[model samples]
Target: MGTNTTLKRSLGLWAIVALGLGYMTPTVVFDTFGIVSKQTGGLVPLAYVVGLIVMLFTAISYGKMVKVFPSAGSAYTYTRETMGPRVGFLVGWASLLDYLLLPLVNAVIIRLYMEALLPDASPWIWVIAYVAFVTIVNAVSMRSTSGVNFILVAFTMVLMVVFMILGSIQLYKGMGTGTLFTIQPMFQANMEIAAVLTGATIVCFSFIGFDAITMYTEEAKDINLMPKAIALTVLIGGGIFFAGAYFAQTLFPDVSVFHVVDDTLPEIALYVGGVVFQLIFLSGAFAATVASGLASHASVSRLMYVMGRNGVLPKKLFGYVHPKFRTPLFNVIFVGLVSLLAMGPSLELVSALINFGALIAFSFVNLSVIGYFVFKKKQYQTPKQVFSYVIMPGIGALLTGVLWAHLHADAFIGGVIWVATGIVYMLVMSKIFKRDVTKLGMDAADDLTG
Candidate 1:
């Protein structure tokens, strides 16, 4: 009922974890398997392992920062608190590129799936339907959205289990690799490290949702549980990806088996099981899109709400939370409307630009840990503190830096343009740096030591 209203703290550990996993969309491994397998010379699982390792380090940095400043703004809050409002504003603005477009990405994927199912149908219809449904679910209540996400994620995991079992049976029956257990899928005699790293860069984006857990810190019943939730989300999501890729790669060790390498989910399903199973697997993929859409839609809105509350954006619109639903109703609808862009953009084009923003946010969050603890508080007193404050996040910063180096040329160019626009907006908002962009008065040191 009031402009000062906050999001309800109704989400527990499992509920938060469910939203994180839903944001990750565990079933996505199948969609990208063929392309990554081709890139890695059929070592999709190993690439995921590399990606998991990289993401774990960053996840640790996220865990550390959330403990210090538990807010819905996530990287923006961490960066702003440790770095400065200007830098934090830029980071949040860049992160908006990733968060805002993700729901649209899911919608685009759904349209593609529907087009594949019914060749003559209008893809726009599916996009509109998906955006509307996910938007409504998120607008109603955060708890209800989490409940729906849990069911979708659970159903997808069960389907993944089924796929793995069927693949194992096929392997035992003298299929592609002729054995259920083999080091071939993970490593081949002539595999190149460069190839595996390239594949890792591609699949690393799969871990994007883990950091998003931090966005729900304000809504978490126990904020202290956030660090654990962040770690578990990354590990669980990574494990699901690795296991799924392991089975798919083992059963079809050669990428030549697929007719289309770019989009391999349908082919992987059809080959591993049968016609009926392919249909079921497709349904699981659709469920994954819905789950991801709902989670990301909720996350971006909350992030916007935080920015709005800070006066970085229009406070009246983006900052408002529904008294009954306890959600950012306007931001939800705004994201839903933005998702309609799915009708116009190609999946590849939209997908290319996502990692640029994500990598920026990831790199900054890692640096924020060092900025807050090591530089700001001077916490380098002992080996344990040094490790926690410096070395751990230092590694995270370095890994994300590597990922940044591997970003696509198109993505880098697009991201730069987006960041440039944000700079202009920030300059206009601050009236050429004459005043503070945010109204929050809490000092980082006080929050850390309090």
Candidate 2:
């Protein structure tokens, strides 16, 4: 690949935000409702509220960092620029669990949906087909991927609206809550705070895509527009999750309603609107998975490309961009191949593991804000600067830290192993600090703008 080859600058603010929303997968609220409902003791909406609040603060920090360093590496780039190369590489390495596995999560979801519709068919067929289609769309170009995502996101939003209407009618007709204005979904007298926090930790997985938007900085038509795009993506996606959860929790206040707590989308649809609506809702869910798969597949490839271009990985293959398509062709294909692992893992396991990496990345990005602005730039002389640089991101760091503490034991163990492996690789690459690990053949100009 030529050193001059860079990501194309074709995405505008709306396009970037659409891709971010696609990555977030709005339909996920229904998919995870039963599990969260059980975890929160029937307060899924409240847990989403907590999750959204946590994400909003972190989103602010992300917006701040992108303005300072507009690169395709997202948290990795911000951390590297603010902290140091080694720390950045470690964060990026740990983040691979979230960035890389998200596509697999989508593939797994697609398989589950297909399996429900056709129990006798081989599920691997759906996984392979979904991965291949998303890979091909992403490999084509950023415009093509974003365009497809916009349509898919639009379709999902429409279905969500229809669900809200149907759910409201059912509630008014004396179902679960028997009223749309009831606060039962948000709170109950016996609900425990600990349970809500635990549920929040799991739902944090739904907010992972907003940060991934930073991975498209180099591809944005105007880098300055990224801050708004990032904030809007979080707000819009969080709003959808909150609304969807509210309706689902109201329609079926008890977790016992779901036969499969780990996957309740089909049941929720069937209960709310019968067989016809269930079929329609499944189509929307499929569209959501495809949209998320395409967006995540695109973002992770760009991230790997950045790491490779920095000489932290096999630069020849991982860093190479196809001149004709202006996309990370090899990285796209590699991620698609990795996504095939979807056939092996359970949805709950993948969801928990994703939260582990996401929380780590979120914690570091918040820290990156302080490291860059308050400590390094010394911009905290005034009250406003102090709040923006110190207080705000500090809160973000604290909240994410709290969530990190609540991660599933299995996820924590797996994340530690991933980070340890990265440390060992960094040690070998740096030759025990004898040489630099990040500056090898890295072209700073290419990272700034396409």
Candidate 3:
């Protein structure tokens, strides 16, 4: 059993990468990029390449940050140092929303996939029961949970490997037939910059969580091994994502006919399986989704624990550590309650809300890197490499911002409305105490300077 105070730094370079890829490749990547083919029609791989490159720049920033000032807070401290406390607080707050919604999305999706296999189990029962089971599993210890993760990740990878091999072979077998699986259309389809850029933006989201591995630096044994871990992670994570996308195209050669806009990974799997292996296709997905739900619970809850330790939020609610299991008990139960409450809306709405918040946080991370490196060049000595970090990442940030706008207006409006309410509450409390934000800012500045 791992204790909170004694965080085991046992995860090595490869394990870290596996975690990132495992969390990503499960139906999420397939569900996300399968739509890219429909939207771009055969040009999906190009968009994926663009996505992988864009992520590389961000990965560079994350890699550097991990070497320099690795922390449990991924964007939290980065925003604080590069931007300001206000922006830092916003990043942390937004992360709370983003990570919180992630688990819920998994919870909801797991139910759907599970039911596709069972066909009669109530979704509510599946979600609640799974949540309870995973919550108990998480409440134990990190070692046990990680043990489970390794097994589940390996199984899912095997499932994906088979899917890729079979799908790719099938695509090649039917090549030059004007089928979606043909390589001809991938380049022949709309090569316009605007469409490619938009597709690239969406594709990038599929690869977003690879860097979250760096957040576990505190639990990594060899500090020098961090770079190797990240490099391998990027390679493995990117490789799987691209492979999955290509396999998806292989599965549905008439890419235009595939129904990706509705997020149909298992359906595509079923399509490829025919009636013989239809249940088998969904079976792998069902297991992956179940593991993903547990992984989501374990990760999102840690953010609360970190925030409490840092004094940015109340230490009381966030500081509790289970004596025996040594897990974040309060955080696990808290996330469960919050997710249960969030089951208020249709699963699709909840999914959009989470995706919105995550992208917004990622967008700011890119912008912060660009602003800090470009405007404040003193922070980074890589002047010769300015074109990559500043020019490219700056463009990526702008593109992410555009997608932030492109998401559902309901999420946009709701996020804005929620932030406004929080700001108002902050203002009223400060005013009542005769304290101004300017004074608070000065105190924070003094603390940093001191």
Candidate 4:
């Protein structure tokens, strides 16, 4: 993408927020419960409501932290400031792993839906072809990628909203699941709260990237506008998540009350709305997944570049921006290659490796918040800031940790391996640079000297 000219910092608050929400548009957890009704019975929607409440509080603390420290290294920088460089590298490195696998996952998901649309189309072809397509989009200038992202997210959200409204109207006429809200099934005799929790961890990941806007500080139109933009993204994104889950529930009321996992249930939307609605839903999902795939690739590349420039990595990638677009073109290519490599495994197997890094990063942020505020109390941050930072982060860490433990073994194992890799990388970098990693980025951003 750097084939031509220089880069500029021009994205506004709306663009940044769009990136976050666009990435989250693929979170279709309600559909999952509808598929797994053998376990949750009736309580699926209730769990979603609980999750929203928990997320709102944690998001408030995250917002505070982002405003307090505006830097490119989102989680990586946040953890480093509070816990030290090693932990920060862990944050950055594991995140690198997460972003690397994203495109692969999304491409596979695209195939999953494509098969539903055209059963004759094989998934392997979809993965390979779609990966190549998204890679090209992201490798170009930010304008093209961001522009496409806006369209994908806008269309997906609008489609979901239309579906929800129509579904609600049908329910009013008793032409649907009858518009009834029943808490009775939530606590049914067979409700597997544990399984729900496990499922919820994966379900919850759909909401993860809402704060990705924080990573664009150096290039953002206004620094202070970040908090408002981020907060709005989370709120609006949550609204969509709820809408997808509840709307499905309302239409396919007993959607989760059965046990059939061979295909997505409560596909009642797809079932009732006929072939056209189903195609719209599936295509929007594909767009949402690819939008996120592209955004995450960009994010990880920028993060890798940040760490690289800070002497935290073996090479200086953070400084490697596209000469033409002024965006991180090298990082985008590297991320795409890694994603392609990960696709060698079964998509189902690789999918398990997906959420671990996210949960760990979430845990680190929660802890980092507490740790940062503890430092702030001593480092001259205000009392109000310190209190909010420490207390809220502490709670976030606790809840996140509990939630993390409930995740699948693959998630936990994937997390450990990624962390270990980060640790080893830092050790090698320390020897190469012959300097402590902690001192890398403390210098002013303007200092370009080695």
Return the lDDT, model 1, position 245.
Answer: 89
Alpha-carbon TM-score of each model against the true structure: 0.95, 0.97, 0.83, 0.86
Better of 1 and 2 by TM-score: 2
Among these predicted structures, which one has the highest lDDT? 2
Cα lDDT of model 2 by residue, 259-287, tens digit: 88878999899989999999999999999
Q: Candidate 2: TM-score?
A: 0.97
Candidate 3 regions with alpha-carbon error over 4 angstroms: 1-8, 33-35, 41-43, 168-181, 188-203, 253-261, 341-348, 370-382, 385-399, 402-411, 425-450
Candidate 3: give the clashing pairs.
180-253, 180-254, 181-253
For residues 241-318, write the lDDT of model 3, one tens digit per residue. Answer: 676766676556445555434456666776565655556656666666656656567666666666655545555667
The order by descending lDDT is 2, 1, 4, 3
The segments of candidate 1 whose C-alpha lies over 4 angstroms from its true place after superposition are 432-450
Off by over 4 Å in 2: 432-450
Scored against the true structure, residue 127 in model 1 reaches a CA lDDT of: 89
At residue 96, what lDDT does model 3 achieve?
68
Write the number of the candidate with greater lDDT, choosing between 1 and 4: 1
Q: Candidate 1: worst 10 consecutive residues by lDDT?
A: 441-450
Task: Report lDDT (CA) for all predictions.
Answer: 0.86, 0.89, 0.63, 0.65
lDDT string, candidate 1, 149-189, tens digits: 99999999899999999998999999888997899988889
RMSD of each: 2.3, 1.6, 4.1, 3.7
Return the lDDT, model 2, position 98. Answer: 91
Q: Taking the tens digit of each residue's C-alpha lDDT, what string does model 4 give over 1-450?
A: 332233457778888888888766544553354533433454556556555555665677667667667776677777877787777777777776666676666655666566666778655677677778777887776667778888988887776777777777777778535754644434556667776666556555566666466666666777787778778877888777766666666666565333434236225546546678777767777777778877776677667766766656534454566776677777777777776653345443454566677666767777776776576556437777656766667777777677677866877787788788778877776777788867766553332211
